[model samples]
Target: MLTKKKVIISIAVLVVLMTGVMLLGNQEGAAEAENKQVTIEAVNNKVYVMVQQVNFIEKAAEIEFKASLEASEEGIVSSKVGGKVVQILFEEGEYIHQGEPLVKLEEKEAGNNLRAAESQLSAAQASLTSAEVNLESEQGNFERLKVLFDHNGIAKVELEKAEIAVKVAKANVEALKANVLTAQVNVESLTDSLAYTTISAPISGMMDEKSVSLGQNVDSGTILGKVKNISPINAVIEVKQTNLEDIKVGQKAKVTIGEREPLVYEGTLKSINGSADPSSRVFKGKIQLDNPDQALKPGSFAKAEIVNDQKVEIATVPLAALAGNEDSCYVYVNDQGIARKRSVIIGETEENVVVIKSGVQKGESVICTNVTTLQDGDVIEVVAE
Candidate 1:
């Protein structure tokens, strides 16, 4: 009953209607799939969490300075008088005490001179004794002549002669006594010179070196050896000029010795240099260490860590939680079950622990382990074990 052209057009219209239905059905299916989608967990917050906040925390600070371990007291020993080295009592590296003889010079001439002076002193004493006896006898004679003259038994001229003899004998005795004193002084001088032949230590320490051998001539004030007292050693460290404010006298410092493990020493800051090195811009600070066991030696390399102050109970977080520029730190904190971005003020980072001045609350969960995939204000479900 229908024409052929009308039948063909009707077939084309039916085909287009079926295609539209198929396309609509496919789009509806895609919408259903999207509504049923689940969130992909991109952050594992439990893996990198801090176990506990350490109180009384010390900031990580280092002073990489040119340092030296030296005896608190050190000196070079020298001879006070010039002499030939006849004998050395101690060898190099020997321990010596104050006033301990270290060397002996040949004192043949000194000994002879001392003996001659003693002999002169003895002779002068004998002369003094003889003059004293003559003077006593002359005085007695003068007294007798005076008494006789009063009775007119002796002439006045005889009394005058007796008096003159007494005066002369008294003068001779006084002169001889003075000569004895001079001789005694000379003997003492010679004795002291002989003693100078034996050079002794001026301090108690280890003698590290010897400059002269037996029979070697030396001059006064010449370096004979070195005496270093290693007890209570000294350490010198260079601190940055910026840290000069923190460094002060009487602050405690810890030092490690000689690259060895478990060998540590505690020291007190002794002095700080007023001026810094112009080229390096670093100042020098000295510490006094107690080395009672004498384990630390002079010139030994040491590392010093000085603690200027202690950290307080401020907001702190793991170093991994920090984001953005190093100076401008941020963290992802949970706000009402949603991930929120917070800008925090920070200070004094050490050993993965960063101090927060503001913008983070205590006991609030912060994105610790994986924070890169989080967006601000995105709903999140806290995963708990």
Candidate 2:
């Protein structure tokens, strides 16, 4: 009976020892697995990313204004003389230079009148010359008669007749001289009028409008056509009365059509109105754009993005790096190997760039790639941009 009790006690003690050893082994295995998982997570958190340093940028705001484009210089071409449009020399949209002939008016009649005036001038001049010649001969004859009469070689009647002839010749010559001067003035007037029959371009430009055609009769001061310069186009815009102070001559602007990406242009503010518009209560402004190739057409709809002279220094980051909802916009910045979250206030977004209005410092590196996969404290690998 004592042997049986001893064996039972030993068996119970052995069972207790085996259970304790198994429990200790299980605890050690669980601890090792936890440590392995932690190591794996540390390795997986290190993700490759591209980063860019934050830079202080000059802040610019776009002030949109609707405008119409026009030629830098435009004018109406008109005829100076009343005549028939016998010949149309230029077509609409034709490029021309200053003093270039654009239209011809009744050249036949004008030429005839000019020639007639020239003939009259020649006849009057010839008459004047013949009278002068006769006067000289009569003066010589009168002098001879006076000398003969004084020497008692001729009668007083002969000397008096010669003197009368000379006086009549002198009077004829004076009348012819007056006629010559009158003819000369008439000739000049006709010549000037004849030249005016041919209309000429007043400025170097392209013909935008044509009102006269062949066989068309047009009176003086009649509209013939319109011409406009090609280079350096102008965009005339209207600004609100309250925003007039933000616009001024010499300010730079970006010009564009509505959603026409390929047609973007650079323009400069050229003029501002001296007074606000009374009816619309808006102010007039002008921006000039360079069109060296004459690609942009006048009278087109355009807009000007005028930037004010006022600028503020702000930090910038890549647009791709921004994350989170509108209520909580943030960026990931690399501090050593860990990503630090920064809440930001955004300003203007220009293409792939965004202005960080606040919550960013210059010279700080910002994680630009793998932004969505990054957490507030995740590790990052900065790669070349």
Write candidate 1's Cα lDDT for 98-157 as tens digits: 889988888887799999999999999999999999999999999988999999998889
Please, what is the whole-model Cα lDDT of each candidate in the order they appear? 0.78, 0.86
Query: Of the candidates shown, which would achieve the greatest lDDT relative to the real structure?
Result: 2
Clash count, predicted structure 2? 0
**How close is every model to the real structure, measured as TM-score?**
0.60, 0.61
Q: RMSD for all candidates, in order, please.
A: 8.7, 9.5
lDDT by residue for model 2 over 207-306, one digit each (tens)? 9878877888888899888889968888889988778777778989988865424367888999988888888877788899988877778888887789
Off by over 4 Å in 1: 1-65, 237-248, 260-262, 270-286, 309-385
Candidate 1 lDDT score relative to the true structure: 0.78
